[model samples]
Target: MPSKFGFIYHEDFLKYNFGKGHPLNSIRIQMHKELLELNSFFNNPNIKLISTKPCSDEDLLTVHTRDYIEFIRKLSETGVGSVDDKDTPAFKNMFEIAKTAVGGTITAVDEVMNGSILHAWNPGGGFHHAKQDSGGGFCIFNDIAIAIKRLIKKYNLQRILYLDIDAHHGNGVQEIFYDDSRVFKISLHESGETLYPHSGFEDETGIGDGEGYNINIPLPIGTFDEAYIHIIYQILPLIAEFYNPQFIVLAAGADAHFLDPLSHLQLTSTTYIRIAELVHGLSHKYCGGKCVLLGAGGYSLNATPRIWSLIVSKIAEVELKDEIPVEWRSKYNEYFNENNAPIRVVDDNPPKIDPERYKKISKYVDEITNRVKENIFMLYGFFKLIK
Candidate 1:
């Protein structure tokens, strides 16, 4: 059978480094690829690995300002100064690498749209913190927004769904599509009051025709798998069914993992896989399996690779061993000079939250979920509600 899935990747993708000690190291991409290789994901006939070219200026201009684009290009050539207020820095040839990241995601979109593949993944994309004229949070280009614009303009399709499960809010993507009714953007992120960019709240729904099109579910810090999974299962299916989207775009960031130092949301590999499975099922049920997955923020060297590998394996319909491949583990130990590299794909059990506190947090989350459903779903004619 022809391949049903495409994996957009290239060696040059590893060049989008933000320098030493930056949280968004490109090495995590290599680690994920190596883990997948060790699991023999490449041997599957239904999955194809794809290489992509840099996006042209015109393609980028569809979402970013010409001045911002030129600024990045100039910095890339000169190798001086920071790109944003502070968090995102300019690296040598960063302009080209960022363009390639955008191009990789656009390429995946094309594969899915043309019927060459039912689903596609670009581990190099999902720089959701970048905006039209600036970059932030270690992101140089808003790949997710640009690709969504391309899909709408090229295909003339309406009702696209953008789902972000990253630890931080997808403020860039939300801002880009805030006034557009055709794209429905939903983000489940750590509360902006506690995270970077600090803006995704329950009340930031869209304006004008785009009103009720944008949904944000901001969870409190230290949220665990049970509450996280419950909120997703309750709201996502209802939204997908009501929207009846033409395509689904997911920003599958692994920074929410408990081991990640940047964020406090307590998720694990098991929850990550379940989230992927839920999204995959939704794609097939609503959009003929036309789903595009993009990599977002994931900082923990140990958790990031394993989380992404689980997502890829789930997408490829392959079974993976719980134990990390011995060769990969040994290599990790030698490279990091640490003898305590994880020996298994899954994380050790996360500590339990205090019972009274857990109950209070769950109640708050449920209230937020109900508020979203009430405010948005009623506009879409979903009256039953999740009580």
Candidate 2:
């Protein structure tokens, strides 16, 4: 039997750090790995730790233009100025680090597509904001798009499902595959009006051949677990049944969590676990368990790791201890000094929604769900699934 899960990691992933004050710190990735270690998650016989190297230019050129690649190369050499809009800084050897991050994602795809693993997670991957001609939104390379392009080129796979639960819209990936029907992109995120990369609106479905292939369910602010999970279940199962995707790519952004500093979705570990379970089942049902999970956005050092760990636990079929390890907490406190370090592996007291607020959110989600059903479901001839 194949390994159940492949976790792609590289030490240089830590080198992807932007700066001291930047919210996108690499230490959280380290914390996630160490927390899994402390919890004995890696000791399972079916779990394999995979290493990666920098992706070649050929792989990057699959999605990025030559000029943009050269621009990044020059900036990395000089180590001066920002990669894009000052959100991502240009550092010495930054190109190499970004390439390695992309490489890790490719490695995860290789492991899964080769049948060496049923599932994989690249915590360093999911730089979904990077476009072909420029990098921004804290992304230097479009790793997600490159990986999808590789699947199309190398594996000749069609009907690839790209599900992004990131707080922000997967703008780059959506744009790159916007006119292609081979890839089906669905993004559920905080409303672009309220967040960065302000896109992913309901009307921004897709264009040309990709019309109705791309789906965006932008949620209202203060969306909690019940409303979030309800929208997920209502949409994804129907999509799986209709699209029958051959591969699944998930950009799992934990920033939707209530504690996260960036986005305002107000989710908790409850929603993450349900998402993991749903995606895992969908992959097995339609794609023979071929799935890749990529770390996207999560600002809170405390909640992000815990949320990721919770997803991994579900995918790897391992039961995690409710209480975070005492020793791991000590290590976390020692290194990060995060006052909000999680004491439990899952949220104990998730943010409670006020009754009036929940009413508005529920109504809004219901409207969004109906709009998506009418817009995209019709293209798939999914009239019955609409209700």
Highest lDDT model number: 2
Backbone steric clashes in candidate 2, count = 0
**Roughly what TM-score does model 2 have, to 2 decimal places?**
0.96
Candidate 1 per-residue C-alpha lDDT over 193-293 given as tens digits, one digit per residue, 9 for 90 to 100: 99988899988899987888999999888898888888888888998888899999999999999988899898888789888899889888899889999
Structural similarity to truth (TM-score) of each candidate: 0.96, 0.96
TM-score of 1: 0.96
lDDT of 2 by residue, 1-387 (tens): 433999999999988888778889888899999889988888889999999999999999999999999999999998898888568888899999999999999999999988889899999999999988989889999999999999999999988999999999999999999999899999988888998889888887788888888998888889999999998999898888888899999999899999888888899899999999999999998999999999989988888889999998898898788888888887778544545556888888888789999999999888888877766557866546685
Residue pairs clashing in model 2 are none
* Model 1 RMSD vs true structure: 2.6
